[model samples]
Target chain A: MSVDQFLQYLISGITQGSIYALVALGFTIIYAVTRVINFAQGEFVMLGGMLSFLLISSFGIPLIPSLILAVLFTAIIGAIIYLLAIRTAKKASVVSLIIITIGVSIFIRGFTREFLGVDSVRPPFFTGDESLTIFGALIRPQALWIIGTTIVVTIILHLFLSRTMMGNALKASAISTRAAAMVGIDSRVMALTAFVIAAVIGSIGGAVMAPLVLTSYNVGVMLGLKGFVSASIGGFKSPIISVIGGITIGVIESLAVGINWGPFTSSYKDAIAIVALLIILLIRSGRLALEERAD
Target chain B: MFGFVKNKWIYFLVGALLAVMVLIPFDWFMGKYNTLLIFIGLNTMVTVGLCLLMGYTGQVSLGQAAYYGIGAYISAILSKTYGVNPWLAMLIAAIVTGAFAYGIGYLIFRLKGNYLAMATLGLGLIIWILFRQLSEITGGPDGMGGIPYLSIGGFGFYTTFKRYYLVWFFCLALLLISQNIVRSRTGRALRAIHGSEDAAESIGINVAQFKVKIFALSAVFASIAGSLFVHHLRFVSPQPFGFLASVKLVVMAVIGGLASIWGAIFGAATTNILSDELLLGFGELDTIVYGLILMLVMIFMPQGLFVKLKEIIVQWRSKTTQKV
Candidate 1:
């Protein structure tokens, strides 16, 4: 590929990767705290996009307020999902937890489809729908928004995690709930905070990327799977690692499609990333098993 | 002879139930729902295998429909495109699916719990994609049709009634086999592993091998169900083998009380009847209902409907007897 084309793909990949990174960050936080995969994490993103779109287009609300409302609403839903579903299922096996999260995901999808209809919708862009030339490669304004939001979220999350007492308590509980409890940190509250944070991040991603990618009720299925793939790429242990992993997957996927050689067509883009994930998983299986057993 | 009959009341009950099952399709009122019954039987076949794997062996597979798809595609291609005998095609499909699962399980069973679920989910999606993308072989998303039905000699399972009996025959046979396996020494070892893999290893059980073998066995069951499904419908589509279908299978397994062999029938029948009959008019409400059922069941009664109901009935019986 030519340098311009390569840069174009790279830019597009990073833009897409930003969304995946946000979703992966959600997965990382929840998994870190609760040890549950929370298959419905992607639904938070869907809710954010759809809620903002509905508020702006259908309800005739302005963009900025609608985005704030959407994110807040999604965060509330995330809290409800934890308090009503996850917490109530006390002492559930891993298999049961997975099934329950899947149940929540299906419920969210079905509820959205019933109420909002299945047509894919896109909210208007934050600034305008104009492409800017960046070093011979064109980048959409919304793409920049997505990338910028990811960077800002990453930096803020890093700061919050390191420079805050509450964040330290959350991390402490994740390390060992018993130890954290002995030090007066309620693990349940930490888990709820993690869910809320995950929701906020996921919703921010959805609202920002909605203009670039259409939002729909069923979008969560693929988005959730891809986010999980991204998180798994980082062994689901660290948020920063998940961010890098997400970008790597996005770049590989975009480049694979851009190459347009043999089976690396656009149609097989999803498969390429998944195939990569499977390979990585296989390589890391021994370590993953040991780590899980240690838990 | 009368005393022997009284002494073997459980055997008499089994005989009566079997007779009722066989006669259901012949009855005028019940015969109308033969298609539903056939679907329930087919699902029960898959759920039973899943029950053995998840309920007994303590492994979760969220991608069972991949095996189901493999079986359907293999049998569909063989019988329709290649003009192979339908029975031979089914046997080949089951064997191939079992082998495929054996290979996957060997690699996949290394990861426990949630990771295993993710790997299987990914596998299922990849297989679904292949079914949609392999236009030359799988007929792509539009799917392949016109597969021949299974037959013995010249008699074919041409009607819903005939296929109903055929499906239940396989379903019940597998169910019995699963029940027998659950009662055997191998079942004990599986329970041991389920309780604690490390402990099972310390006790000299071949945990990995057993898990892989059972995984293959469950895949074969799903394959058989797929074979039966395609032959009955005379069509194969990629849609039914997607992630949703795998979740539905898990629902059936969970509803049936994962380890309870007999509960497979109850679970499959309840879910099929609910979706196909009772909740059809509600349209999208079925999804919400299913989601509710899954969550509520897992939360309130993870022992499953059958086992919980049995517990309640037993407790009631004891109370009544005490009062008497």
Candidate 2:
């Protein structure tokens, strides 16, 4: 591909990568605190986008307030999910937990389809839809908005974790739930906080990217999978690394489609992340096995 | 007579079960539900394998539908396009799916728990994508049809009655074989690994090899079911082999009491009845119900519905005898 085309793909990749980064961040926080992968993490994103649209169009609320309400509502749902489903399961095996989260995902998808309908919807862009020339490549203003929001969120999350007593308690619980509890930190509360934080980040991503990518009930399946891939890229440990992983995945995918050589067409675009997931999993299986054994 | 019955009641129960199995599909019997029974049989074949993997071996596979799709597509393509005997095509599908599972199992068995689930899930999605994208070979989303029925000599499994018997035959055989496996030395090793992988490894169980072998065996069962499904329906489609179908299979395995081989039959039958019969009018509400069933069952009785019910029955029986 030419330099301009490369730059164009790069810009678009970064924009999409920011969304994946937000989703990965969500996964990381939840996995860290609760040791559950939270397969329904992507549904929070879907909820954000779909709820924002409902608030704006059905309730006749303005865009900014609708987005905020959507995020808050999604956060509440996340808390309920933890209390109702995840926490209720006493001494659940890993297999049981996985199936439960999958059930949550399926339930959310079906609920949305029944109530909101299956058709894809896109909220109006934050600014203008017009593309601006940057280094001989075109970039949409919305793309910039997404990337800027990601940076701000990351910085604030970093500060929250480092500076706040609640955040430190969350971090301590992630390190060792038993130890955290011994230190008088409520591990259950930490898990709830983790879910809420994950929801906030996922919803922010969903609301921000809704205009760029159409929002729908079933969109969570793919987005969740991709976010999982991104988080797995960082061993689902560090938020910073997962953010970088998300961007790398986005760039590779964009370039794959942009090049359009052989089986790299858009038809096989979804396969790219999954294939990456398998490859990375195979490569890291030994280390991951050790980690599991350590646990 | 009562003393004789107590000594030989097991045989009597087995004889009665065999009779019921044989008589159920007759015209005067429950022939109207023959189609549903056949589907339950097909699903039981797959779920039994899943039971062996999850219940016995303590491994989770969320990509069984990939094997199912592979078996169906291979049988469909070979029998229809190449004019191969349907029986031979089915055998080939089983072998190929077995090898594919072996290869994937070798790579993925290293990861434990949730990561393994994710890897298998990714594999299923990739295979589903292939089924959709390779339109020329697999007929893509429109699906391929006109596959021939399985035949022996001149007789063919063309009618629903014939298909039901054929499917149940395969299903029962697999269930029996699975039961034997559970009773054998290999079953002990699998249970040992499930109980504690490290302890199993220390006991010279060769954990990885056993896991890979069981995973391949499960995949083979799923493939055989797929072959049967394609021939029975005379069609192959990518839609049925997606991620949701894989989840459905796990749901069946869980509901049937993952550790109990016979429970596979009940799991498959109950799920099919719920979805295909009772929930037909509810549309998307069925999905919500499925989700609820999975969550509630896992939370309350991870040992599974069938196993818990059996436990409760046994407890009640003991209580009644003591009162007597």
Candidate 3:
């Protein structure tokens, strides 16, 4: 409500939003290329966080090296998910594809449960746990890392997609696999690249958020759904739009908590975002239908 | 023979089914299986409705468990708190759920494919949140209890054996009704819609109305199942009726062959047994196993277990005849 409070919520919202954006970016890349909404995307995020925690806490590995390995491991798992599950169901219907991704998600979650146990884990912060006060609003250092990395990743992704040959090929395949194939672009290769990139980004999201929110086996579903909401709200048109959507969702959710209506506390946090998901989806699909009709 | 049954062979089949239905509850050996049978029966009601929606109408709903939860909560609240008769509560739950589903279906059916699925998934999660958050009404995470049993003419279906019969009788009636619908002109129209919505519209089929109707019908089935479930368990909980339950329901519908009414029974029964008996000791391994089953079935045999098994049996029969 007050400026300081507003700033505090804004900082927190943006921090959370960055994580969602990363996950949504994962969703966006895969959706663009393969037209499959990979439900296992969140599992990659979870694996990133949990793996980093395991490496750092238990193995006593340095933070930076552990983070790098965790990200790489998650990316590998992402590719494996694609190779094992998504690629195999190439000719399946949309419903089948959704189920397959969900299956992979469940498997990953189960595997994580077995490997990591059901308890939550936290990776050490990239920087020391110092809270920086910017204009009377305290921002956790990990929050800055989350926000900073998201921006950097978005900029890099934009440059890569626009500036590189491989990126263009991936984009081309996404726009139309048939045309891309005709032009000698390997759609399969593009798809595989998309999965790898998405996984990498999702892992980054997981690694950054682990310090803030404690990574656990079950967090994948909630995180994945949040990312999904962001992607849908973003209209899957651009990564920028998804980032905005994620921030909007975070801000709204934070403000909702700030308001503190009866039964609208932290417990109903997921519900608020889901309501936003439905509304945005309704509006987007309605407009999309209109666009189709006009065309 | 009645027009619905059509032939003497049909009458004989019906007579045999009736005999088995009667003998099951009365047999001493069947006593332990009664509760499991009751659960399967309840799942069948929900799965059958899901079959009509997903298989016949080609609309995906990942929120059937939410409807089921609504039904249970409604029955529990009305019968327990308001002191309404449980049967009347069940009927009310069905009507209210049908209306709710109809409203949501109309709004959401516009989105096709993955969007529809995601929307339904979100809806299920929201309802789940409500089930957990609305503690005053739903009893929060601990869930509501003391739900009364369904009865007829002052005879309470209190015992597990009695509940088993009551639930199965409802399930069988539902199956018969579903079969009748599938054979009717409405079924044909639904099939047409599934084949192609644009084509169905061109043929003067009210695709939207039919979809909404079927969605409502499926929700009603889930509602009835929820009512029966609450009464049987004499408890209502938010824990069981979550996204996983909805996914399991979809799994049943898919495994049973989506369009086959009888397949719903097989799918529900098999899934229940797998979760209760085989997978229970393994804990969350059930989720992974279910996921594997869903993927494997979708990949190798999209036609579903019933249809594929039937084909295999037919092929084996021909081989046996050749050997003879």
Best candidate, lDDT: 2
Query: By the DockQ metric, which is better: model 2 or model 3?
Result: 2
lDDT of 3 by residue, B90-179 (tens): 999999999999999888888877788888988999999999888888899998778777788889998988888889989999998899
Docking class of 3: medium
| Prediction 2 global C-alpha lDDT | 0.91
Q: What is the C-alpha lDDT of each candidate?
A: 0.91, 0.91, 0.87
**Candidate 1 residue-wise lDDT, A1-295, digit = tens:** 9999999999999988889899999999999988999989899999999999999999989998999999999999999999999999968999899989998988888898889998999899899988999899999999999999999999999999989999999899888989999999999999999999999999999999899988998888777878888999888888899999888888888999999988798888878877877788889899998889888
lDDT of 2 at A232: 91
Error of 2 at A245 (Å): 0.8
Ten residues in sequence with the least summed lDDT for candidate 3 chain B: B1-10
| 1 versus 3: better TM-score goes to | 1
Every model's DockQ, to 2 decimals?
0.74, 0.81, 0.69
TM per candidate comes to 0.97, 0.97, 0.95
Tens digit of per-residue lDDT, candidate 3, span A1-295: 7999989988898888888889899999999898888988898899889999999999999998998999999888888877877788799877778877877888788878877899988777788898999999999988988999999999999999999999899889988899999999988788889999999999988998999989999888888888989988766668889888787888888888777787558898889898888888788887856543432
C-alpha lDDT (0 to 100) for residue A275 of candidate 2: 89
| Highest DockQ model number | 2
Residue-by-residue lDDT tens digits, candidate 1, B1-324: 866965698688889998888889975658988999999999999999999999988899989988988999999999999999999999999999999999999988888888888888888888888899888988999998888988999898899989988999999899989989989999999999999999999999999999999999999999999999999999988999998889888888888898899999999999999889998876566677778878999999987988899899879977997999
Error of 1 at A244 (Å): 0.9
Each candidate's root-mean-square deviation in Å? 1.9, 1.7, 2.6
